[model samples]
Target: MVLFVIGIIACEKRLDEEVFSELAPSTLFTSEKGLSSVLNSSYAYAHRPGFQDSWAAYHLASMTTGEIWGQGGSIENLWLSEIDFTWDGNHDHIIAQWTIYFNSIRDANIVLDNLDNEEFSNEYKQLTEAEAHFLRGWDYSELYNLFGPVPLYKTSTDDPLLPRSSESEVQEFIEQELLAAIANLPVQAPAYGRASKGAAMAVLCKYYLNTKQWQNAADVAEDIQDLGVYELLPNYGNVFSIDNEGNNEILWALPKDATSPTASQAIDALVFPPDYPRPNPNNIVFAARTYLYDDFVNSFDENDTRRNYIITEYVSTTTGEIVPGLGDDRSFPYKIEFDPGAVGAAAGNDIPAIRYSDILLSRAEALNEISGPTQTAIDLINDVRTRAGISPLTLAGFTKETFREAILQERGWELFFEGKRREDMIRQDVFISNAVSRGKNAKDYHKLFPIPQVELDANPDLVQNPGY
Candidate 1:
């Protein structure tokens, strides 16, 4: 299996002449071990580093909103540019993310194409195929949201050039893939990190939300709640605690292990205060460059237990004195807390991509959209508020518009710094307006990021997203 793993790398590489010349799919997918290795490689792209420190999708999503700002330092301009909506197609972050998503899709396709290759048992083949479909759907979901209609590759191909699919076509493809994945995936994965029926349902719920399919979103979310396998953790803080990696609250998360390079999340090292204590000799300081915006800090009620995760001040390592964080420097998200015992950037804290709380919120939003304010919706919102130690909302004179606003705000407060802010803002149609209100020169065209210039250059069929 160890020797065959090299062939897995070739199978997962870019669909170009060099890779095709180097290795064929027959060489890698000839056995269960080989197919499994390539499938694992596909999952690796799920958490590409965004800038120098933060996860790319999470960082870009967080920075674009008014909730956060890049603390001034190295690559400060780059971060600020994204927040200001000034980044172009050539931005390295944009290019890197584009490659990650497409490469992930390609890798998933490789496994899907070879699933029937007679080298694997029926049980192993079904499970691996389900995992591949989920990965592909997940990657496409991210790519579709960020870059608009990207070239849809259903199978591995020798042709490097492809045209973009219509948004509707891509959406339908994602919907079908997720539906198929849901059928094959178990209600709960054998391990915390693997895909499951709940994960596929969660993704479908989000897709419905994104496409404004209100009733479908509501129904699917309700289906997830009815699964009876997930719930909100009693303590809000523990939800992100390293020890609570696979708590019931998490629907799907990227599993991290301190000793496994591929499994660890470096987010803690990137978010920890610059001078904070470290376990080893590495000067892995990326703290000051990313912090919560003052407005976001003030948005929280003092009694909200979730506020405990957002650090407003920290004691200096040099002076042993308390220092308050202010403005962009005032509040740092300590959500992924510093791990003094971690080796290098490897912090053993699983990053939740979808959680039960998120499903609850999305369901509430969809219900409100469908039938105004209903008790079921209010109860759903209240469930999350209660967990956050905040007073729950009542039905007293609640209009649909007001309830919608409240739910959106609730999501912002609950899911801050978790990489869903940008998507939330866009769904609520306030993404550009919020930036403009905060003095950013943002325009409507900034809603979707520019398709990377590198992609456009290599593929003649590609067009730069409008306003690039």
Candidate 2:
């Protein structure tokens, strides 16, 4: 395994020169250090800022799904309009997300293309090649989830023009790449941010669940559990705490540290109350919805420990008085609580990409789908609930349909504000209906986002998704 030294100089140099150099891949892949440098650049792409502004995939997915809403203001309105479905293909965030994921895929392909060089040791080649495949699979998974079917670039090429692949084809590609990744990756990652066998399996499991391959999803999820590399953290709130990073529950995370070049947690800056004490006293306060929806908040049992992560009211740090979270200025997510020493957006908290709890829930849902409400399924769901300090559930007499809805609701409660709601709602076939019920101008075509007008103009071969 290549021992990655944490430094920006080498990675920056590789990224700067490799993309434009005709002979860089041949020269770089011949040496272990050279190949490691290129792989570092590919890994860095995972943490690149998604949207230019505070609006990111985390915010977009939550806002569009009605789990949150942007507080209205002049600067905020720019992205909020698009997020609320008022804008179209020309939206900046839409274009930025498309660019970010494609760029990541481009970098991953570059690493993959150089892996077969004869000079590299067989073990090193296998390790680095698996990492490249994992990164590529991950990028494609994000692209497929957000934009539906995107162009499948299997190798690094100078050609920027490629037609979009079919949705099934893209899913199949992701599945095959991740399977290859799983075969070579270790059960646990050697480093904090690196992907592992468990991480690859997690993504593949989700893919199966999305495609309604119940048995495959269940089997993959079960495989992860059997690996014994991860387990749920005892405290639900501690899962997101900066001090608790690399905990047993985290399967994969984007490593963020105060000293790193990319060293901030935007979620904290985006979801804090306006009057809350922050490192910068003048920092703009970004809130979630005016409230977390009465039904959502009410769904939790009174004893649920997870409720601590959602603040409905709090004592003002400046005024030393209680503040009510109601009306337009409502409850905000406290998952990314606060880093007392953190100033501006620089916090040491790592962003979780996949967690053990998610795997458990996926297993439960998949099992339920395959065989109504089995005890194994109920036990998995109850495991998550039990961690949240709620009473365990029993199969009792639930129909297949009722059990499916129950699992969906369980996912919402467990994964809210983690950027999984929109996809979950979409898979459940309630995305449009849910939006309409919440008083949005959502249409059936809105299910797949527009292919971004800029992309359409740049690539004549590209076809836009329906309704955009």
Candidate 3:
């Protein structure tokens, strides 16, 4: 994707009366009580419309499907076209992402600025600042990866708008911020949703992985694994179930409170059984293109419980002939879970950001980059598969390259539809060429998403990406 500069709404210099007056600037620094609210707002931005559950997040995940949405006049169809530089101003993904990310950035900036003052004691201030930096880095890292370069905002300034930084500069800055954050942040936060040292390191690892800084990425993954706070869930199915939340296997997740409508809504209801009395645009009926491949669907042995848990034999009730149960062989494979009565609203099911399985694969990938597939790498990979109840492959037959390939396939199985396939393809250097071979309308220029035309027209200082 290309960098987009839009007319970002400026944040108020002072907090609004209704929201900020309760805690005046005087009160904000009087004690740690005022500062805790700052963290709450950051978490709120994370879950709100312009952020986490918004179109920006969802569409990024969906586009990896490489097909336009089946419905003729859908927002995602525009993304499919945009992937080939064939889209125009109506590109909702770009617009939504631009608005939400910038808004979140502004909020993070406010938090960072307020936390820098000396009113609070050094230790608490340092911890709070670490949290703010982690969030700021997270926002910039997303921008740097999806769009090549983005304006780096450190404070709320009244000066003229800044031009975008180079991608490398942005990435380096993000890495620095995460390093600072990891040092100051606690190993674990009081709440699961709050960013922790482990989470910061995980994000840092991803940043290195994206740039193909394999050695750095491996080192970071190793650091995260060394924390020992996380472990693989005994069963893959348990990881996705609502009951399984708060499981130690999850390093971090977006909090979805079912009681409060503002809390996270269950995501499965929207993506799963469409006709099961849910949202208006109920889970759009779609099948996994990869599961159709024999290597993926049948990769597991009969004893592999993950095969049954993760890949449900997806059956479309709309087909009107037969409705195979989720795990039935006749059904297709898909993630299914739904909250009835929440139409066009957020789902209650928690969206996982980092999990033990992901860590395992990251470790395997990093080790492969470091020394080909060492026994540790092979053992880690096999550990995941073994937990899935799949028969372990002989370590004697594994080579570095072969093991790397297996890890990729394993990721497809483990993290599918979790918004990672495209990044994985990009990291592996196969995104563009593979899409072209798959008959997608891709070109070398299409490797990055186009800068929305509206943004190009509005921001005179902004530059359009190559093919757009």
Candidate 4:
């Protein structure tokens, strides 16, 4: 397996030609090359040891079904419960998530603070600042969405204890940052790993859509579509192939190189099967909650190719294979495989934040919300369905409410395992109660995750959410 090692140069001194201490952020941010290095470092840190755990991806799936509970350890179980949790102040998962989010924020602040210096060009500096804004906004959005009313930090500070911001305040903050980022960012990033205007738009759509500002979300999604640089990949499965790097569908992705020294094993270990005799060392996988439902299984007619691509009844890897008809096999979505190693190995696939499919779905949903499901919405949905080789829904039998349900279900089918189910359910106003009867947790107060105890202990200024 090839690993991509980010070049680490000591930034202790300016190089007329000599390299210096690599660890110091201050030294690194002084030069153009050094500044870029600092940005890469921040990216590296996002996927580093303290940031993502198996729960990062698992939580998204765990909200669904067929996921093993006891296996992820106690933290997973605590999160799975439909009630408020009171974890120890030093719970590793909480601390890890808190620290990494802030760390990325701080790094972005450093970049924004220094990008305009004479050493960098206007274009590069503008792009750098845009990326920083996107990163900061993106980090806070993550915190706010999962754990409502999180502390907000504009500039990095030595004061480790920060207080929580109100949910409205946090949402406003994300929108503001993302808007500015959209303005400064390029429509298409020069590199696969960097943020772009489309990325900003995607985040804006997510931010507005989640907050129920459907009109705003629709407008921004339309803007992204107008960019004309992105499109749905003709082949549904190719979008996730390792060889399909920088495909037009991807708006923003966390660039992953298996060979990179800085890489962490990604969802592969969790998504792929474990200990199958044949595919033994090839794709290590895990099963999660958001497996599949009978409604979904029956929704697609025999000709719908998406059903084949999105839902898998059997687990297949380079190693051994379980017979497809087995009961265990039916529960797991075999689309993606887990690479075995430690608990969470860095899977080579780049994690996509937003892609063309997201825009299409968002537009369809937004149109439904605003104009009550017009032909435009139907066409857009069918566009994606056609790409997936699914039969198009004729407007004849489709009503606004029916299309809304279809759109959401289609999102469930299309975007499953892409870290979106919880948010989708919540946005559609189905999360807090519907999921409960559906064999999942959906208490009104349980909509948002609890504030990690460590944050509260560190700062008396922070208060727990209503339920917690």
User: Which one is best on TM-score?
Assistant: 1
Using lDDT as the measure, the top candidate is 1
Per residue, candidate 1 scores C-alpha lDDT tens digits across 1-468 of 222221122232111111222244656567776666667667666545223323666668888887667654465677778887889987766777788777778778888888887657889888888888898888889888888888989989747788898988999999899998999999978444668899989998998898889999999999998999999999998898866667888887866555555445676555656665544554366544567877778888989999888878778887888778855456778788655556666666667888899999999999999999999999999999999888888888899999989998999888988989988989989998989988999988898999887778889998777776
Better of 1 and 3 by TM-score: 1
The segments of candidate 2 whose C-alpha lies over 4 angstroms from its true place after superposition are 1-29, 50-55, 72-75, 260-263, 278-291, 317-319, 326-329
Looking at model 4, residue 229 earns an lDDT score of 88
As for model 1, its CA RMSD to the true structure in angstroms is 4.4
Cα TM-score of candidate 3: 0.81
Q: After superposition, how far is residue 168 of candidate 3 from its true place, in Å?
A: 2.5
- RMSD per candidate (Å) reads 4.4, 4.4, 6.2, 5.7
- Candidate 2's clash total is 1
Model 2 TM-score is: 0.90
Q: Higher lDDT: candidate 1 or 3?
A: 1
Models 1 onward score TM values of: 0.91, 0.90, 0.81, 0.83
Estimate the overall C-alpha local distance difference test score of candidate 4.
0.64
Q: How many angstroms is residue 48 displaced in model 1 relative to the true structure, after the best TM-score fit?
A: 3.1
Q: Deviation in angstroms for 123 in model 4?
A: 2.9
lDDT value, candidate 2, whole model = 0.74
Ranking by TM-score: 1, 2, 4, 3
Clashes found in each candidate (C-alpha, N, C closer than 3 A): 4, 1, 13, 40
Clashes of 1: 4
What ranges in model 1 sit over 4 Å off?
Answer: 1-27, 49-54, 260-263, 277-283, 326-329
Lowest summed lDDT across 10 adjacent residues in model 4 is found at 10-19
